[model samples]
Target chain A: MVDWLTMTIQMASLAMAGWCLVSTFRDQPMLVPHLVGMGLLWLLVIGQGVVSAVALIGGEGPEETVMYVSYLATVVLLPPACAVWGFMERSRWGPAVIAFACLVLPVLMVRLEQLWNPVV
Target chain B: MSDTTAPGRALRTGPGRLLVAVYSVFALAATARGTYQLATRFDEAPAAYLLSVFAGAVYLVAAVGLARAGRASRRVALVSCAVEAVGVVTVGAVGLLAPSLFPDDTVWSGFGAGYGYIPLVLPFLGLWWILTVHRKDRARAV
Candidate 1:
């Protein structure tokens, strides 16, 4: 895994999560800008997926190929899925949903790192 | 079904939507893990894997129940959440008392320490949300 890319994604998601939380606190619904931010985050996740897939194809993947692939699929899907769900929810909690999903990303990244380098 | 949900007051609306989103994510995670484990090596740890599958199903049902607006859905959500609370407590206790009983870690192992204890707390939160937020028509039923 590319440490810099993973760190960048984690940082971006955290930043977006902070913004979404602020909106939620202020009783604001998710807006267009939030969707755009989600789109950017989704793109980053997709990039990670592609990189990981290529790495796996090159035989430089984790021992648990299925687990890694499954996590990758989920990582790529979450942003868009949560974004659409948030869009349908026209309330302050809409952004809260995104914020929660963003928080989950760091955990998933950590899990990905662990799966890549299992402890002996 | 009990009654038509009030406008903007359905369990699927507002903050309830957020709860449902979280539940759905857990559902997906648990289901994926359970399916993978069960398919790959169910014989190695049948009990733990079966528990994992059960937890996944509970989460799925809870998410669906909470996201649908109806009396039946509300009942479904209530029952699922109750079951979840009981299951987590029982599994956590069993895992703690007899760690050897489970050859592998289930989602409820160590009271969901792997998932940051969210699994332990989620059911209580669900129950609280249902009791308080959807308390309108269910008062008599309760």
Candidate 2:
């Protein structure tokens, strides 16, 4: 996993979470802009995933390969999955769902980092 | 949220939507952890892993029941939430008193502290949301 990419995803996810929180408080439903933002975030996550996958194929990965890959798959899929789920709802809670997913993304990235580079 | 018990205003709108999402995540997390442990390290801790899988199944049921948004599913979801609440407390207590019983950390171990204690709080939230929706729907119908 690229360090800069991981940092970028975390920052972007938090920013998305903040934006969605504002929308939730303002009683605004999920709009096109939220979806667009999620789309961009998903693209970034996919990039990180691809890099990790390539590295793994090249035999540079943690010992807990299965757990790490499962987590990787989850991180890659989460944004788009939540975006679709949230978009289906036509209420302020739609953005709330996105916000929750966005918040989780950062934590998952942290976990990924630990898995990728466990410290002695 | 037009405050109507309309068809479109099903259980999976508003707060229910968020609940469903959270439940789905837990379901995935618990099920994954349980299955992975059971498959690879079952000899180390069978009971704990089983409980994890069971909890995951309950979460899955609750999520589906809420997302489906019908009277029957509501009942299903309600019962599962009750079961989940009881399961967490019982497991948590066991972990505290008889740690040997678990021998490993399940989702409910230490009241879900492993998973940031959300497992402890989730059932109550689910109960509140489901009951609230039922009461509101009934009140509007009347």
Candidate 3:
């Protein structure tokens, strides 16, 4: 796992989470810009996933390869899934859902990092 | 099976939407962990893994119940939520009292201390949402 990319993803995910939280508190629904932000974040996550996949293919993966791959799949799927869930609801709570998903993303990323470089 | 949802007040709307989303996450997390543990290390801790799988199933049922807007589904949600509330308290207390009993950590172990205690609090919120919706639904009828 590239430290820089991991850090970037965590920062961006937290930022997205904070913004969505602000929108929720302000009684604003999920908007186009929020989706676009999620789109960008999703792209970043996908890029990280692709890198990890390539490394795994090269036999440089972690010991628990299956678990690591599953976590990656979940991380990759989360953004778009939550985006659609938020989009379907036309209420302030829509942003709340996104906020929750965004928060979870960073945690999952942290877990992924741990799995990638387990402590000996 | 019968629909009891109010106009613009479906089960998975407003705050309920957030609840469903959270429940879904829990459902996925718990089941994945539970099943994985069951598959690889069930012999190491059968009781704990079984309980983990059960907890995951309950979360799944609760999520589906909350997401679907129907009279029967509401009842299903209410029951599952109640079950969760009871399960967490019972398992958490037992785990606290008899630390060695589990031999491994389940979702409700230590009152979901591993998952930031969200498992402990989730059921009540689910029950509240279900009841609040039920109340509003009843009020509309009367």
Candidate 4:
């Protein structure tokens, strides 16, 4: 995994979380900006997924291959899932959904790192 | 009490919708992890694996029940959340007191420390949403 890409995703996700929290606190609905922001984050995640999948195919896969793949799937799926659900709600808490998903991104990234480099 | 008796508010609206999202994630996580563990090495830790399955089941039931937003669904949600709350606490304590009982980490082991303790808090949040928020929203509607 590219360290800078991972760091950029983490920072971007947290920034989205912060933006969503502001919307939530202000009792505002999830507007187009939030959706766009989340879309950007999702793109980054998908990019990471493509890179990692290519690496794995090239034999740089983690020891816990199954777990890593599942987590990778999770990282790829979450933003879109959250965005669709949030759009369905049309309430302040809609952004809260995005916020929650964003927060989970870093945690998943940390897990990915661990899975990639399991202690011998 | 009245809110519990009131025609049962829609759990897929407002904050309840967000709760549904959270619960759905946990349900997916627990179920996926449990199935993987059981499929790969059930013999290594039957107790923990079984508990993982149980936790996943509870989350799934609760999330679906909440989303359905019916009287029976409300009951299902309540029961599942109650079960989850009790399961997390009891399993957490047992895992701490008798580590041998859990050779592997279940969703509730160490009070869900592995999963950032969201497992420990989720059921309470579920209960609060079911019991209190519905009442408050109903009152506001009146």
TM-score of chain A considered alone, across all candidate predictions: 0.97, 0.99, 0.98, 0.97
Error of 3 at A88 (Å): 1.1
DockQ of 3: 0.59
Over A48-77, each residue of candidate 1 has an lDDT whose tens digit, in order, gives 888988999999989998898888888889
DockQ-derived CAPRI band for the predicted complex in model 2: high
Interface RMSD, all candidates in order, equals: 4.3, 0.9, 4.4, 4.5
**Model 2's DockQ score:** 0.83
Poorly placed runs, candidate 2 (over 4 Å): B2-9
Q: Which lDDT tens digits does candidate 3 get at residues B29-117?
A: 98899899989987999899888889999999999998886778888888999999999999999997898889899889999999999
lDDT of 1 by residue, B1-142 (tens): 1244452246877778888998999898888888899999989998888888889999999999998867688889999999998988888898888888887988888888888999999999888878776665466346
i-RMS of candidate 2: 0.9
Q: Is candidate 1 or candidate 2 better by DockQ?
A: 2
Q: Give every collision pair in model 2.
A: none
lDDT (Cα, tens digit) per residue for candidate 3, span A27-85: 99999999999999999999999999999999999999989999999999999999999
Overall lDDT per candidate, in order of appearance:
0.88, 0.93, 0.90, 0.88
Each prediction's TM-score versus the true structure? 0.90, 0.95, 0.96, 0.90
lDDT of 4 by residue, B1-142 (tens): 1234335555767888888998989998898888999999989998888888889999999999888856788889999999999999999999879999899998899999988899999999899889875676567678
Q: Candidate 4 — which pairs collide?
A: none
| Residue-level lDDT tens digits of model 2 in B1-142 | 7665553246788888998999999999999999999999999999999999999999999999888856788889889999999999999999989999999999999999988899999999999988888878877777
> Which candidate wins on lDDT?
2
TM-score of predicted structure 2: 0.95
